[model samples]
Target: MRARTLLTWANGTTLAGLAIARATGATIRPGRDGVLIAEGYTRRIPKNTCFTVGSVIFTRRTAEWLLADERTDLFGHESRHVGQYAALGPLFWPAYYLFCGYSYAMTGSYGCRNALEKHAGLHAGGYDPDHPLRPWAARFRRRRSENG
Candidate 1:
């Protein structure tokens, strides 16, 4: 494994991901490019069809489904997140949740304004690439524009 991959394990995020996968009854398997796929995560609350932590990508769906031809972009999107996890180490969790809160506040959607999601490619992650802001946020933007 490369240093970046090693870094994730060293930081414990990869192990945490694997633990989460096992806890949720997901089937763990190797994926292309040194990443792991954990499929069939049974939790319904988070709502995202797929999410990545360190070198592992967890999905509520099958690996085949997430890796389907048309969903190649989605896989790529999640793979980019692996790099992010490596870069951010354990800090990725707190940073990501902060982004989620910021996104929800601005757009009423968790992924819309999230910097991590934006950097990873919103369309590829099954999110609207040009999601509109919430009504209040739009009004706030308009006010700021007028003031400027």
Candidate 2:
């Protein structure tokens, strides 16, 4: 449709084909609202985890997407990622992984501290938007305290 949308699909196909293929048995279709949706991926991926490749959103359950009112915001959240793909082009994957690593190192959680995830609005993706970033060592201390 739009040039940006085209770029999104191109980047996604080139960079994330394995992920797309992993979503086998999922119903793949174009959304009326300019998104690509692939659902029914539970056989391949964990339930409740949705991954986006460009404009394509892959999920385990189409019913949850269709029925849940809160899911409407998820589309907006994912759309921002699609925009990121369009902007970053081939560099997106590497950059994304770098962000994930940084986030993990800083917060002991990837999404909570990831710049891209934060830009996309973590709350929209069912994550805490204002989560405090704890040092990695803090995780071990908390666990040790719990055990002790």
Candidate 3:
């Protein structure tokens, strides 16, 4: 295991992810780099087609869908989440949820203002990259017009 992967394991996040994968009956397999891919997730609570926890990435579709040329951007997006898990360890969970709530409140979209999602590239994650908080976008437009 890489140092970063070991860090997530030591922190218990990766283990938790693996446990979830097992419970969901997803087919687990090794993926490129240090990430693990868990596909055909049976749960529908998350609603997202893809999500990442620690070094394990869960998807509702086959892993080949993510590996396909057209979806490489999404794969890269989830890989960034693996790095985030390594850095934040178990704290990533709470922090991510908090960001999700905050982002939704601010822009009515969970990924719009989320630090984690922004850092991971919203477009790659199938989010609207240009969607900004309404108030902020309005304020910026007002300021730009005034300066002209």
- The candidate scoring highest on lDDT is 1
Give the TM-score (vs. native) of candidate 3: 0.87
| TM-score ranking, high to low | 1, 3, 2
Q: How do the residues 26-55 of candidate 1 rate in per-residue lDDT, one tens digit apiece?
A: 999888777899998889867888899889
Local accuracy of candidate 2 as per-residue lDDT tens digits, 47-112: 446767766677776835743677778777777777787888767788888987987786766787
**Mind giving the per-residue lDDT tens digits that candidate 3 earns over 15-99?**
9899999988998888887889999997977888999988899999988887789988999999899889999998898999999
lDDT of 2 at 32: 37
| Candidate 2 Cα outliers beyond 4 Å, as residue runs | 12-23, 43-48, 63-68, 135-148
For candidate 1, the per-residue lDDT at 62 reads 85
Q: Quote the positional error of residue 138 for candidate 1 in Å.
A: 1.7
TM-score of each: 0.91, 0.75, 0.87
Question: What lDDT, from 0 to 1, does candidate 1 have?
Answer: 0.88
* Clash count, candidate 2: 0
| lDDT score, candidate 1, position 55 | 91
- The better candidate by TM-score, 1 or 3, is 1
- Report the lDDT of model 1 for residue 147: 100
Backbone clashes in model 1, listed as residue pairs: none
TM-score of 1: 0.91
